[model samples]
Target: MTTCGDGRLTCDEETIDTIRERVLSDVSARAPFDAVTGNEDRVSDGAVSGDARATKTDREVAVSVTSLSKRFGDGADAVTAVDDVSFDAETGSIVGLLGPNGAGKTTLIKSVLGMVLPDEGTVEIRGIDVYDRPREAYTHVDAMLEGARNDYWRLTVRENLRYFATISGVDPDSVRDRHDRLLAQLGLAEKADVPVRDLSRGMKQKVSLASVLAGGATVVFLDEPTLGLDIESSRTLQRELRRLVEEEDLTVILSSHDMDVVETVCDRVLIMSAGKIIADDTVDSLLRETGLHCVQITSTDLDAQIVSTLRGQFDTFSANAREAGYQIEVTTDSDGLYALLALLRTSDVTLGRVRTVEPDLEDVFVDLTAGDRTPGER
Candidate 1:
């Protein structure tokens, strides 16, 4: 007569602890502009906030795109990668791009970078048209498209930085002082003479970052800087990023899935689904706007009938039986939690450990992109 799965529901003590233990995070790269950032960002309670308190008074439009679109193949094989999308990225900020699989994040970023020409729409960087004026547009920009692969495996860390800077037209000699400083700041100074092939993946990633920053580009587009990085390494990268934006007067546009990077680093988030942007706002605002808070409870006598009653009374409710009792998770707004409390009081089940679960990037991501889909006749 037991249906609660024999007390097999294990508690998530991992997600239950400090922030560093949970590194993968969300998106909201609004001011803190593009992708990835450093520490020194203070997050509290159950919400994710902006990385910086910088105002708009000193900010300037860095990258602008109006009505962008892209598609792959044609007819039956056609896959609409990016729909008519448009948004502005501010100077000296990190913006995180998030989406489900097949989402047009990559296509949108590529079209903006001019790597993939948009069938329709235009992309502008620092007032230069990226599509029409590639040279003039690229002069103020640089990108680390393939993460660690962006470097030459045989080149020394310093050699890679100098070589990339020169190819990108940033005079290595003129920026030598700046280059050395960046290496030191990014914790790559000691590894400067080490061959790229000899460095760990995380070190290589940092090298890629130094190369990008060394160019003195105003805007940098990073696909996923935190990918394959460990907790400490990721934290290091995030810290260096914050320093770069603050000291270098740099602007970044990053796309990543790690919620820790997104929620902690990005100033605002742009969530794309299918081929369109579904949500755009600061992380704190987005979480608050979702209006959903969760509560976990254990009951001694919860049965199928009582579980159904609870589910009927709430939009987001789930219960599972265990040998000790019933484990229930109910997600609702403020008033709904109150209603739930009232319902529980009158029920025959003996409830225990009813506490609020802090809403984080994962919750916001699931709710916003729950049904992320394209609105075309398929």
Candidate 2:
């Protein structure tokens, strides 16, 4: 056994795996409400549900943001970074924020993190206003931002965890058992003594994650957790995060451009654009609400008027100019496809190819953010 700085007699990395297995076994046997993850099949193969998790026992509100708004610059130069965004995330659920580059995803998360103050609205942790009660709010929250900046570069993985947990007011001795288990689960047992700066980007990120999970924080904010990792590394980290939420009873808010991570890990999704919340709901519900499936349409001498007519009916209509005419992909279902075909024949256009294709999250994302106005115009 190795002695930690806080005088805890804990088995160091050499024997952590064995201890972790015993700990996890005990932890996993709890009741459904107390199990590693309460939501059934919410995550599969490192992907969130296309439909989102269907059920979970009710839990108290973990984080609440009300009518939050922020702006930069002044007068004509003023640009709203976050526009009246509001949402509530319950304990043990993962909520995601997705949007294009300037869609205020970062600003919204920053406001919640207290990294940037919101010009309007309130942020609360377990109903305590974060802006008004930062010290108290921080006790229940921790975030792993991009770049693993939450961690100290020169500190060893074990050292970082001990430091962060203590500074967050968690007695190291009380959580020493968990601290070892986290190191094991993150695959850092062999390198627990290695300085964080000596590790790979993915390893450093995992170390950062270890810090977050060890704090006993009621809420966790992970900003682009998968940003710089490779495929396998990404998958590994994603799996760990899923387990952390389920087993730890921790609420999570995720911000990512990677829809796969968001869809796989999040119980609910909030889509941002133009400094405002344009969509908020489950991923499956959002896909269903789009009322769309793929139907490809190819034509010879495709009349411009017919394309215009189709556009009026279908929210998504993309046409590729061809030598003879054009090929169009329309987002609709079987019944609508038939109607479109009938309409095309009525217009006397020579159709080439028409068929259905699978739907993708990208499709839904495109549809949700589709608008003609450039960022400057808005």
* lDDT of model number 2: 0.75
| Tens digit per residue, CA lDDT, model 2, 44-142 | 221123433223476778889899999998999998888888889997889988888778878788888889888999998877888777876666677
Q: Give the TM-scores of the predictions, in the order they appear.
A: 0.75, 0.71
lDDT of 1 by residue, 10-129 (tens): 434343333312311211111222122222121221011353333446677788888898989999998889998888888778888888777788788878887788899988887778
Candidate 2 regions exceeding 4 Å error are: 1-56, 296-355, 372-378
Q: Name the lDDT value of residue 77 in candidate 1.
A: 92
Worst 10 residues of 1 by lDDT: 23-32
- Model 2 earns a TM-score of 0.71
